[model samples]
Target: MEGVFDLERVATFVAGYQSVMSLESAHLADTARRLWWKRMTDFWQLEFHYDRNDDSCDELYIADEALLHWWTERLDVVERTFAGSAQVPNSP
Candidate 1:
């Protein structure tokens, strides 16, 4: 998650492809899949600072939007689940 938002191909991937099952839409609000996107975004191009373990390094061609969308999916799923859940009866 360091130095992200610089630029990546994920946005183009999502915009070009609209398939929900595909990687493009796998992290969309509908599917609620984030494990993949998170993995990608969290990746850093440590090639330059691998030895030093510097976090202020550039991302490995990651998209900040991709991460944002991916994270939002979790909230979206949670909200939907709670919104549709039936009220639980209180047992005194």
Candidate 2:
């Protein structure tokens, strides 16, 4: 069966988003640095789980506070980056 989203791809997207935004300001750069580690931890902690009944590994059944906050912050950076780019491709 296929998953709804690819965790690795999500992680890569988040990293790329952070890298692009880090160029704007020192504070944003720090946030992006922290976010990279947070994303890695949150991905493994919240995205991977074990099924008790089946005794097998599985994707998470639900999202949690940490993951929610992580994604929200990630989206915020991505939005800001997109909004700021007037003509440039904004590649990072």
Candidate 3:
């Protein structure tokens, strides 16, 4: 029997995965970095602020509205991609 993959659940999982592994583990550091980069690039168009003299930079914070929409779309894409991958066997 083929196992069912819930997009919503998988999306939630991905979000949690991204959150927990974003900066803590080397294994997932790259994946988290890519995700963050994509998020910033897509919405902010790579616009950012920096203080040359202070050697400080603005932090990256996702707006609530944007985060909701972005997560919804992101989860859908991730779930679909995982579902479609041959390596991820449908039943196993």
* Top candidate, metric TM-score: 2
Tell me each candidate's TM-score.
0.22, 0.28, 0.24
Q: What is the C-alpha lDDT profile of model 1 across 1-92, one tens digit per residue?
A: 54322122333344456444344232353343344345545644555467566656555345544555544544543323222322222221
Highest lDDT against the true fold, candidate: 2
**2 versus 3: better lDDT goes to:** 2
Backbone clash pairs for candidate 1 read: none
What's the CA error at residue 63 for candidate 1, in Å? 5.7
Could you report the Cα RMSD, in angstroms, for every candidate shown?
Answer: 12.0, 11.1, 13.5
lDDT of candidate 2 over 4-83, digit per residue (tens):
22344444555577677654544554564566557545534333343234423333423434454544555545433333
Q: By TM-score, how accurate is candidate 1?
A: 0.22
Our tally of clashes for model 3 stands at 0
Off by over 4 Å in 2: 1-24, 44-48, 51-92
Q: What is the C-alpha lDDT of each candidate?
A: 0.41, 0.44, 0.42
Q: Please list all clashing residue pairs in model 3, or write none if there are none.
A: none
